[model samples]
Target: MTPFEPDRSEDLLNRLKQDDKQAYEKIYFTFSKELLYAAYKKTGDRVIAEELVQNIFISLWEKRQDLQINNLQAYLFGALKLSVINHIRSLVMENKYMEYQMLTYSENHQDTANLVDLHDLSSIIEEGINSLPEKTQEVFRLSRYQHQSTKDIATGLNITEKAVEYHITRSIKRIKEYIKNFYIFL
Candidate 1:
């Protein structure tokens, strides 16, 4: 590629600062390929390299009025290098976030599986409660399901406190046996 003459480069820079579209186009055509090659060499990806170079030109145009470029070529190359570094940093952060999300999802999946097992155990216990004698079912339901105290259960059922305790113990023993047999069959 032919290098820009010193006088011509000075003229281009002055015109570019004044928002001259033709000057901007000349600069783009002169430097775009070199910048793309440099970006690709650093990043090793053609698409990313192209995007970085494009963004550099876009930023140059947007900030043309504010730019005080002593050497346009050096400035463009410097921007390309910084952009590539930032892109790599973003990729690393994205990978770490994805890994964390995957770990959390796996843990949550295990919790969901445990909840399903607990639900099945609850259903089995309900079946055992249903199989109890009618009076025992009333006492067990009042004490466990309704969260009533043993004394309250005896008063409500008009039974002695000892009878309430006996029914609770009997219900627990039968449910434990039912659960053990159910798991053995599974």
Candidate 2:
């Protein structure tokens, strides 16, 4: 109720663990919008922000039975920070891909500035993407390169959205694995 209400967060959390709707609603009302805003600030995409917030709440609920909270705000802020960091990391990888694409575009006209380095990097990345399963590679290109929505891709490919999602997820996992293996040499 009030800001100074002592142990109120704990009580609400306890009630939430007991599957109390009113307590859950209260917690949602008190924190959801702010958390969404924080996630949106980091992601700069409403869809991703909504997913991030939903996941945070779902994870919180799953851990509720054994959850401990010394400071609700601190715990929330920490989660937000981790979500933001993951968002930034994805953005970086996306940007790197965009850079490669732009380089390819410029190559058609004879622009060769930093050509060797760009070619080497692009070759490595291409090998990584190529090593993925054909479905994963197609899904990754459609989603990451062509910037198509999952629904659109699934529709265009005449496949189920869940299958498209699975392919994309597999591609991401393979990419991470590639990066890990490549990093070992460095």
Best candidate, lDDT-wise? 1
| lDDT tens digits by residue: candidate 2, 1-186 | 125243988888789789887876677678778888888887889877866676566567668778787767667668878977887886787688667757765664435644754675577677888998887888889999999999999998899885786676556656766665654553
lDDT of each: 0.82, 0.74
Candidate 1 residue-pair clash tally = 0
TM-score to native of every candidate shown: 0.54, 0.50
lDDT of 2: 0.74
**Quick one: best TM-score, which candidate?**
1
Q: How many backbone clashes does candidate 2 have?
A: 0
